[model samples]
Target chain A: MEYRGAPQATLVDLLDRVLERGLVLDADIVICLAGVPLIGLRLRAALAGMETMTKYGLMQDWDREVRAGAQSLQKGAALLAGQAVQPGLH
Target chain B: MMEDRSQGQVQEQARPEGAGGEAGLYVYCIGPALGGGCCGVTGIEGREVDAVVHRGLSALVHPCPVQPYQTANLEVTASWVQAHHRVVEAAWKQWGTVLPLSFNTIIRPEGGLSAADALRMWLEHEEGALQAKLDALRGKAEYSFQVFWDPVVIGRQVAEASPDVKRLEEEVQSKPRGLAYMYRQRLEKLLREGMEARAAQECRELYGRVARCAERVHVSRPKEGQEGQVMLLNLSCLVSTGMVAALEAEADGLSGREGFSVRFVGPFPPYSFC
Candidate 1:
């Protein structure tokens, strides 16, 4: 995963900006590879459009829910995934 | 003509990437002049790269197929992306600041215009704006900073401070099973909200501190990866090349504080700025 210097910019970071942040010249020049829009990759598995979600005041609520789920539901998920049991969970 | 190009696709029996037959220009970035000699960088798919000068500005491009680089197969895609970045990095290393175009930005003959001609025409039209950006970005590079906090660590810290949560935890342990379940739920809810609020507040403060050192600061979406961590701030900053170390030092200082893991990357051509 190493490139010449600087820990080979994380694929997620590079991909996120590669298509999403740059200047778009027009529609005609934009081509899709394998029927998938280059920028269509989601940022993370569960959280989608985090910036947009945050902008509309939705991320805080979602964050709260996700954090709470991490605290409680992670135990069940961990069990299912066969991860080491974390302490202090009933 | 467009129909002809689309229909002329040659199918590769085993390759999944389809046909990339027609030669087109893959535009990497644009800069002022770039002086004499080629950048000596290879473009996507190992194609030899050179610059096309137009009215004092030069574009680093290579003859790539017009087809988009496939994303379905990540291994192939990653190599292409790495190659793309390598070329831009080469250009930046040799010729200071560059306005980087996005990956897979190919220009093919459309509306009877040749690929190079179309590229030249676009450069001509955007010459003034492009030059302005190049001048502004000269001697500057983009750096990325990401701050993440371990949820367990932050939650434990928050709980230690919140008396209400302490009382709830005690109740959860002592009360009847059904009632304790409710209390535990309530406790988890409060802690989650508090930690989220604290992260947001910390993000604002961190961005302010980092912004002072940068000419342009772009706040990006926080990326959540690990199960027990939350991204506090993700920023791409444009700063003078000389100030990058100072910025990293600042990040190092920030990382020394508890519950914060900082990822700082760059000296990259100002991709976000362009």
Candidate 2:
């Protein structure tokens, strides 16, 4: 039950605050980046390494695609290294 | 065309101050105005952090091109976000309370005004609202509470507690092979429904317990958990600094339960509450 202080807060925690929460202003005077897709995409890519994305059910298809690509690359490396490919490696 | 001309004029009038020629102010958070001095903290992209005061309120900001801080590079974007939080956290420490702005909140010049002037003007206009929020948030901070339940453990508990599930289990054991398969399917469905009901009940109880120790409660969508655990509740609580210990004790009580675990993090800058 001991709470983690701010310094111990994870990147996901920070993202939840800075990206999603915080005081919103009128769009007229502030550079409104709220709906910009590219930034969202990039932030998701950055968070792909974290468990928060999977926890939130975000980018699952993309995550599978990346994992599939990585497995193929690993197989290729194994072939080049003259090692028997493991069946369960996928 | 006449329409295009008017659109162009509008753009000209709203000419983004920081995007091209003039630098706009990227505001981190707002707080009670302190005497003129550097925040002694660096902000996004190592920009010098300072305050723009209007009446009783101050916005901690750094000058930047009016363009939003955007990048395809993950590392760069993460660094920027972390840096933004650092400045806000610093301000929270210095001011005791603040209204933190979201990332990439750049204030641009409008019409013929300078970026600073535009910021000051907006502050003047929003002074009462800003001061009220700051006052309300004084002596308070935000804490995140996530409750994760081990599905296997909870499922077992449900199976033991529900008469319908237990009757099905015994009936399945007594039936022929083919009949048992169908009965097993029904049992699974029944168990699943019971689990869902239990989850909702647990969440409601936990919410009530935490609310007692918080000034405000924000319920967020629960996320999936690792290791076959399911998140039962995701909450952000605005707690008086003095009540943090009580909140933690409540969380500890929940975590001590058989099938549940809790992630308690924060003393954050009341980001969710603001």
Candidate 3:
């Protein structure tokens, strides 16, 4: 097969950091989604504490995260149904 | 509240799968396609898991569409879990080329259909994107390897090698920086160097082993990052169903190496293959 752009390694690197082990919801960030907890543990704590960390740079990329979270929600719903992703602004 | 949801089950009469009343959620990978293989596999809810043909392709689901699982406790969720696993297991049968979605991915309910408008809307918006990704991962699967160190073994070796630190090891019992503390630092450094080197070495060898077998190799951290720099190697191999044996054999061989292990978990939808 014709290899695509950047090496596969590069994309995997980005995905690992972005998707697989990205910020998970933990207690500190125990935000709910419909009712279920959005995240799991440690990162949850940090996200829960995001408001408090406004003084710090933790929330520096807040907007981007919200967008990603929103995307995940819709994608999650569709993925649950095994539907293809709906094209978004992204 | 949970009880109410359980009670309000919009269930249909149980029947053998593909009976038309029983439906299943067939999956591909990160992206969805109009149709694909899905052939010669069993459906897995209660009976045989299979696919219910929709568009031109079949969505793999339980052969017995409706699973009449009689459980001891109405409230207990064991049957639900088992039913879901059944779906997953059947999907795995074809997961090599097809990336099966997580269990319970029915966009439409059994004996139901997707909202046409929403389906169209999503397809219109995301079809290209999904297609792009699907095209990208057309033939590949994810693989990983992790290595760990035995700190005890290192300590034993260190104790044997450096006799000079023996007295210091005895003196600085606890508290502030002492002889024992210093010896530990040396051990840590050695471990770091040794493990990292070992990790790198294994990675190079692995890359070489799967060289022709893979279209691409993605290296990620090992499952254990702190002690071991987990090298997650993702390979996009344009493989035939038959070549799985070759991949498995290679992995099995790698597993016999020192301080390392290999895990083979897919034909899973190539999330990264594309």
Report the lDDT of model 1 for residue A62.
41
| Ten-residue region with minimum lDDT total, candidate 1 chain B | B5-14
Candidate maximizing TM-score: 2
Worst 10 residues of 3 chain A by lDDT: A81-90
Q: Tens-digit lDDT track for model 3 on A20-65?
A: 3211212111112212311222233434444434443333344234
Candidate 2 global TM-score: 0.80
lDDT for predicted candidate 2 compared with the true structure: 0.74
Q: Can you give the lDDT of residue B129 in candidate 2?
A: 86
Candidate 2 residues B1-274, lDDT tens each?
3453345335434535533664688889999997646457898868789788888888888877777766543445557788989988888888889998888888888888877888888999888888989999999999998887776778889999999999999889989999999999999878877776676667667888988999998877655454445566778999998999999898788878887888898889999887
Fnat, model by model in order, equals: 0.13, 0.39, 0.00
On lDDT, the candidate that comes out on top is 2
Those runs of model 3 whose alpha carbons end farther than 4 Å from true positions after fitting are A1-90, B1-99, B102-117, B124-181, B204-212, B216-221, B224-246, B266-274
Per-residue lDDT of B1-274 in model 1, one digit per residue for the tens?
3332223223211224334455577777777775865577677778788788888888888866676554333334445666777877777777777777777777877678777778788889888988888789888988888776666677788899899988888878889989988898899788866765566567667777888789998876554424554556668899987777777777888777776677787766777887
Q: Model 1: residues >4 Å from true position, as ranges?
A: A1-8, A27-90, B1-23
Per-residue lDDT over A1-90 for candidate 2, one digit per residue giving the tens place of the 0 to 100 score: 323322267766777778888888765778775544335566665544534444446445445544543553443211111111111111
Reference-based lDDT, residue B265, model 1: 79
